[model samples]
Target: MVPRRRGRRPWHRSRAYRLARTAVLVTVLVTVVRCGHDMPHGGAARAGHAAAARPVPPPRPLPRSPATTLRVPSVDVDAPVVGVRLDSAHQLRTPPLDKPQLVGWYQDGPTPGETGTAIAVGHRDSRTGPAVFAALAQVPRGSRIEAGRADGRTAVYTVDRVRVFDRDDFPDKEVYGPSRRPELRILTCGGLYNRRTGYTSNVVVFAHLTATR
Candidate 1:
């Protein structure tokens, strides 16, 4: 990750995202979320990460801009982004399964670099094989996540924690809550895979803005 510049520009203060993130983001595939047994999946990936990170100084938020790309170096995920909306069922929709390499941004929420929790979701793996976020659970704390904005600026976030939650007990607030500072959440299906119920957990990566360029 590149070091943040010392001399910073003036930042804009904005409100937290007010829309309730009520949509259950349970799968990349609308019907079922699946993952192969080859790698660390689900509960096994929930190693405590709170102790692994260094304290980060707060960073000012940038003006709202649609994310164009998302890059997670540790996970080897580099993909173009598309806006995802909630379906009539109020379920969060994902990118096309055929485009396994693409990531979906919650278009109804805050844009990356804004003063709120922005969200991005991707498939852990698709039929084509390991997809964009296939290794998301393995991303270590303190690593950087870059969200490229349409404005040609980039918002750099430092991973604070990585956790896997049982889908039945997913925390709606903690994972999708509004924030005073610019924050981000990267999510994917995780935990154990069950034939009848699909993946049992949701892998969530919590990160906060540390720099912009």
Candidate 2:
């Protein structure tokens, strides 16, 4: 009945139009947030989260070769290696007492330069006298140890630690367990000598390969 408004359309002034405009704006905001484009910090947060989820690389595996010799300059050891297998009792046999200077390596296990644990056994003392590893107990951490392989390669290692375990409390898994890197265990009878029962304990040197040639 009244004259029409000067120039604006009637729909433009309606509540429905205002509500539609507001809804459109809300939808745009939701999309931005969901896409990680909401603001200045959103992109950076996504990048940081992606970095945190990245995977770590696994350790590199070492080469496998039969050991031919062992040298420990600190202990003045330059011994020949011999392959030894487990006995019927499932025990590592001692190197022959006649060859007290000989070192025994487990033939079925990882070689000295291999990725897994490698074991070298020698006698702390022989019936005759002190043996190749008689001075093994005196070898300290951080000392250098080297093993020459049959392939003419050399594996150089650093002593990490030395441990003595009683015969009754020996940790089989710790000494012979699998490892991610090349490892060496120099083992021998230790602790007090028991004429009736043999040695009362075992000496173990834990070392890890640091170089190869």
lDDT of all predictions: 0.68, 0.63
Per-residue C-alpha lDDT of model 2 across residues 143-180, encoded as one tens digit per residue = 99999999898888889999877655555556655676
**What are the per-residue Cα lDDT tens digits for candidate 1 across 81-164?**
999876654455677766778998988777888887788877767655887887899999999999999999999999999998
TM-score for each candidate, following the candidate numbering? 0.74, 0.70
TM-score of 2: 0.70
At residue 36, candidate 2 shows an lDDT of 6
